[model samples]
Target: MPETLRKTFAKWHHWIGVFCASLLAIFCLTGGLCTIGPAFDHWVSPLPPSISKVFHTPSAESVAVATEYMEQTRGEAPAFLRLPTPQDPVFRLIRYDGNAFQTILSLHPETGLPFKDKPSLETGFFIALHSTLYLNRKVIDFIGLFVSLAGLGAVISGILIHWKRLKSDFQLLRLFSPTPRRALDFHLFCTLIALPFLLTALVTGVWIESQHLVEDFSPRPVISVTETESQKNLPAHLPPEAYKELYQAGAHYWGKDNQGFFLIAPHQALLVPSDGKSISLTRPHLALTQIGVKSWNIAPSTDKNISLTAFVKGLHLMRWATGEMRWVVSLSAVLLWAALGAGSFLLLMKQRSALNRRNACPSRSDKIAFSFAESFALSAFGLLPLTLLGLLWLEWLSPKIPLSLSIHAPQGRVDAFFCVWIGLSLIGLAFSLFRWVGSFPFADKALRLLWKITLKGSVFFALALPFITLLGREWRHLPLLPNTASLLLEGHFVLFGLILFMCIRKNT
Candidate 1:
């Protein structure tokens, strides 16, 4: 690069780094947590004592029986029936109220009825917030876009800063040195080792968040069908059972293996069996087919938009990835958070030095920004792991807590999350005020106190897993793998907290 261009790039990197440091940290931690989204999901879902039998292709009637049972129990018609999958032993009846969708379980295929147990509320809510930030579409899209761009900025600047020192810094540590330079070296070293994982996560995250943008750029094709004269004479409102019969008749056209995935319109249903042709048609088109319709007219027309969205969403979240590939993604998440913390500390140390050399403190605005960032980084991130445990605790103890898609059950566990989180925040606040009033060094006293508290909290939350699984009635049937995963993750947090404490200086 030219010297002038290099200098311009360097300046751009520095100021932008400073500008987005706190927000970038928030992004990194949240994104990292999302990377382990599936594992977190498993932690809170109900784990039956025994695994259920897996069927390759269960009969349509068997599915219908289960569907009918769930509807009767809920006292509302079921919108759809999901096939039993390996992860979810019981078949789910997806229904809708005025507000949100709800899933009711079918105990077994042969016996069509709602399961006695309730759905896992805590897991579902966290998963929703993790994926969508519990917001409307436009807001979520903007958040996704901003966070992605910020991460991109960090990666670009981080690479430039570490390009030369990458290899030599791998061995750098600060067991002896207490200088700011030593801290910088340690931060840079971990970040360099984790660079590839960090970049991959950012790129994937951007792709996931920019899905709507992609759709906007390439809109789905429109499908239009003309109504036949015979169909034009039909009543405006069709019978409710009309959909069900039309679906079965259409399945016959495709042959024995053909099964209905979901219903679309009055005369239309999407069928994709193991061995059958898939097509969409109006009532007239279905009439022409070889399958004899017992009663009501039918139609099937395909919409390309729904399929495209499912495919893109699955890819963005790595839903199809199995086993080891999933682990790779989780590891990337850890690296992402590690990089964020290191990057933020680097920016803070640099600013602190500049102030000391000038014999001046940071301006009020700068100090406020710094404090806000620290508070969020400490409390908000801490809330995440804590909230996760609280959620799992609810799952183990309260299998009967009812949560509908639209219905907000008592939200007992959610209330507990806020209680614990707010309590921690208040304690941190009191400590911060104590330092301020005592005229004690804010950096040393306040920071160290926060660090120690965070470490203890993280350890307790993580360590509680074994006992939670063994002692809790609902969790007794759960497997060993989840417990092991919890321990490993807790160990990582414990190490991270200790490192932060040791790196603390006389000043904050």
Candidate 2:
């Protein structure tokens, strides 16, 4: 590349990183956490030790039990039912509990009663953070759209800047080298390693956000409900027996493939097929009445378009990915997080070095901008993981804490997280400003001390989480295998702790 073009690309890359670094890190970390949703769900709400094996209950029977239980407890029928699979044999019914919030109730397959307590708060918290960033759906979609676009630009520009050295430097890493060189190499290595997956995620994310545009531009499909002779003579409502028979018929038709069936309405049901299949989100239903069973097969789109869309979505979301593939995707997300951090670090450090080399007192504006940049970098790299670990600790300790003390378990976890994060941000800002006003070396030492303290505290909490859980609960209540939540938490702590340790060790 020419000198001018290279410099332009480099500038764009650095500014893009500076602009979207925090958001990118948030997305990557949450995306990785979301990939282990099922495992987290299991950890949060494990089966009772009393139930050694799941009972094989009939679908209609389970639905009836869940309905009765919901009506008795919540005074309303559930809006949706998540049918039990072999892996998770408890039926989950979700109801809109007035205020537009949905409450999920898990019921035993045999007795139809709720389990010992509510579902795991940790599971719901992480999921909420991942999906919407705790904001409205449309707002999140808007933010995601812009973030993904900027990310795409960053990735493209980065590749362009590194194209000449791409082959030779792709796998090069010098752990023992100087901090700047090592940081650059590691950043490039991680980016190259996760490029394909990251690109797929970014492109599909953009496509998903632009789906509203597609809907507006595309012609809507017309549907004609033709009444058969039997349907024309049918009663408005089917008897309970007839409904059961209809369910059996639907199960025979689609459930034969071991697909789960969810009750969409009193007389309508939808099938949840195995992952990787191209099926309409709202189609492939069996509608039943007094007359007969009517099956609807409205395609999401024409065969080719829907198939392609579904495939791309599956790749992005990892919905169809197996266990090992999900792990690979999670690892890719981690690498993306590391790459973003390293890139931002390299940019900020290089800028600081440049400013120092000028050998003159910097202006007020320069000092302010550099301070803001340093604080942002510090929050992204340090505060995020610390806040995450703090939340986990809160989740574990909430139950033990007294309600009169002004903290609510599970429900207050999110609030506490924000409180801790804001607190840390304020402290970091103070340190940055302190560094700005004081001598360079003294301020640097103070900042490094703060960083080391924060890192060590995070490490201590992360490493202590599993033992806390084990000791907090009775031995019988513990999982037979290592809980996925604990394992994931520990893995993240170790990975992040190692990175922080390296930074401290290298005096960077």
Best by lDDT: 2
Give the alpha carbon lDDT tens digit for every residue of 61-157 in model 2: 6555665543343333425555565445676665543222233677777666677753335344655676577766667777778888889988988
Q: Which stretches in model 2 have alpha-carbon errors above 4 Å?
A: 53-60, 67-78, 95-103, 212-250, 253-271, 279-315, 358-369, 403-406, 426-450, 473-476, 479-493
TM-score winner among the candidates? 2
**Residue pairs with clashing backbones, model 1:** 267-299, 280-300, 281-300, 283-298, 443-507, 443-508
Q: Supply the global lDDT for candidate 1.
A: 0.50
Deviation (Å) of 96 in candidate 1: 7.3
Candidate 1 local Cα displacement, residue 232, angstroms: 14
- Error (Å) of candidate 2 at residue 468 is 2.9
